[model samples]
Target chain A: MPPLKSAATPVASVLAADARHTVTVVLNGTPRTGQAHPRLLLSDFLRHELGAHGTRVGCEHGVCGACTVRIDGVAQRACLTLAVQADGRRIDTVEGLSQSNQGPTEGRMTALQEAFRRHHALQCGFCTAGILMSLSDYLGRNPKPTEEELRDMLSGHLCRCTGYAGIVRAVMDVTGQAAACDTRSGEAAHV
Target chain B: MKPASFDYLRPATVADALAALAAGGDDARVIAGGQSLMPMLNMRLVQPRLLIDLSRLEELRTLKADSGWLSVGAAVTQAELLSRPTLRDEVPLLAAALPWVGHFQTRNRGTVCGSVAHADPSAEMPLCLVATGGAVVLRNAKRRRTVAAADFFVGPLTTVKAADEIVESVRFPLAAAGSGHAFREVSMRHGDFAITACAATVDGTQASLAVGGVADRPTLRSWPLVGGALLSDLDAALNAFAWDLGGDDDQHATARYRRDLVRRIGRTVLEEALSCRR
Candidate 1:
């Protein structure tokens, strides 16, 4: 019989969730392939395996929408999706949004991000990335959304910092429902 | 919490899936949308030797309507199902109930059949199916069968499905014309699970009631919409319900509170539905 593992012996990490499968996903605009465990979450794969830290993981149970990402043009909870399930799919994360929008280096953030900054929609900003990704995708689908529809869409995300008033105003301003500030700063609007 | 190790097998067809499931037997689990299962797995609540991913089974994703029933495939995502305009027009109650099932993210990948199979007491789909008098179609390597939604849910997170069986689809009977329905739930937050919910359908002079989040599963009952008695004496109507509802007290609310809310919310929903009587 094998000797009992000493109290100090660190247990060998719970068998690694069977990492014998290959997953290939087109993340953002680039294609990425990796060997991942069947049980590994897509959020962890993006953050750990691919070093895409912009995709946050919160309430991995799918309640808090901080881990929201776009899979095949649909906003989805990354925490609940397995990396293996994302095989052969297209994924869009907050990092990709940032890269595509040409933030700061181009002397410009995406109109939505700029709106968030201007309207004081973000406080600590922990929930900013996920919220931005969700709204960006939602707006792409619906360029003009009513207040009730916007509230319903915003209900999916939980933001502890901003009470979401400014976020609402920012989206409205971007959609041109209200008077927006200068587009040069990309920062325009108030709740 | 991370999930325990398990082999993932993606089968191309329902037959292949059945074969894989039969081979894996007790060690296998079917994963469609992974909304419910993934959360359970992350919490380490269950660990299986092999997971038969049913994502590739195109046969299980078709949405079709027949003369008697509207069929929703096992792998059809809740969001996808909600997007179908015909479904919205034909099953208004389902359309009203879908938005309350989960937030946009979860619904994007959550499946109606997965929800039926998970059989969560507070989940919206099973309760909707049960109230709408729907049925669940199940299959195994040997045969296929159907079970009424009311009978399909054995208990919380429990069902009658055998280890080797699969939930093929759910068939909800098309609502008869001139039916007005309403759904409401009391949750701590907008997207959180319901503390208590009420769904009511007004079909002619008949009213069907279903109260969820107050028991191990949604409690259903029906009454004649006679002379506005149900509307006027709502509390008595609720009390009169054969609430064979097995309720318990937990962090959210007490059984007594649930019973009270059932009356209040049930009344509100019934009133709302009947007010907009088709």
Candidate 2:
């Protein structure tokens, strides 16, 4: 049996369902705090309470990747996480991607964003943020990934537009595999 | 979909978690990674009155080898276990199956023991557990017990764990010399629930195959390696096991197709495991 600690601190604490608890997080390098009930999700907290509207919530049950966000440096589903659970964590959403180089009001875009624009990777743009966040984290870890590897990694996100061809092309271009980009040139502009 | 209202408890120690579960009784649910439970909670598939978060308990996060078994603690995430450099040489079946468990994003937050505790019929963790003859370590306020993976799962999304018992860790027996393992699954999408998942282990003259997604729980069948005309006998045995593990005709696939997968993929995994054996 594991021995009990001698500290006088309470072993357990419960946050009531109806009661609101103060939730704090480091949102995109800025410390932010909000009040939420136990049932409130992190996706809803980021959008409604913290004003980080870049993270979208599609299927709240964890199937869809629209709610992808970086928590403690890894991409995770915001909809699948509770607001109170992320109280002291560092969260990075799509808004943080572009804000790194310039302020949120600036017009500059990252190399991956530029590549996406050049390849027309997104049409409706609803799923672009989550996709970008996932790919950004993946490419940072796997800098020179093959097209097949990129496709496998993209399985985490869903995109109804562009058929994922242009997205794959854009990722390939960002990975310095531009020589193979022309193989899908005919499908790139159309997608 | 949104979860119903529930009181949240963050316990700093395993003792506190067990005490909370005992105090909350049948209404309390233990959450480690929340990868599986969050979906059920969001869809209101299970709405508990109290949820005890065990993420803060550092003692439940160890993943190391002890004697002849690889002991994986409850809070060790799937990605954390997968990232272990010695995993492939230590447990090849788990190495092959971990990538097929949901997506890379979910694995980053999904705990290995949590998946075993969830006991999803289509999940890879439980299938690997049953195939490798692993054990689940369960603890309550008073005592601790270890249940074999085969007996741990009672039905789909159901396990033998009592309401007050929390899974502490899971132990997978280390693969010995002259043994090989393989795992394969067929799903609609890359990261979707498998229609039929199979795992096989070839050790000496004995071989065992575990099939999932074709039954309420993962089922295992073993066969002895014979010298002459073994393929025919093995096919007949696999055919019978596939029929015995009858599946339901659902939106993803028909019962006939699932059995077909069992017959085909089961043989393929077994052969693959046999080919890799020393």
lDDT of every model, 2 decimals: 0.81, 0.87
Q: Given the true complex, what DockQ would model 1 score?
A: 0.31
Candidate 1 per-residue lDDT, tens place, B4-98, comes to 88877776568878887899889889999989999888998888888887765778888998987999998899988888988766777899889
Worst 10 residues of 2 chain A by lDDT: A1-10
For TM-score, the strongest prediction is 2
Q: Give per-residue CA lDDT, model 2, range B1-278, as digits (tens).
A: 88999999888789989999999998889998899999899989899999898876788989998798999999999989988999988888999999998898888888999999999999999999999999999999999999999899999989999989988999999898989898999999988999999999988877899999999999999888775112557888899999999889999999999999999999999989988985
In terms of DockQ, the best-performing candidate is: 2
Local lDDT at B140 for model 2: 97
Compute the lDDT of residue B57 as modeled in candidate 2.
78
Model 1 misplaced stretches (Cα beyond 4 Å): A1-17, A101-107, A179-191, B227-234, B242-244
Over the full model, what C-alpha lDDT does candidate 2 score relative to the true structure?
Answer: 0.87
Judged by lDDT against the true structure, how good is candidate 1?
A: 0.81
In candidate 1, which residue pairs get closer than 3 Å at backbone N, Cα or C atoms, i.e. clash?
A17-B5
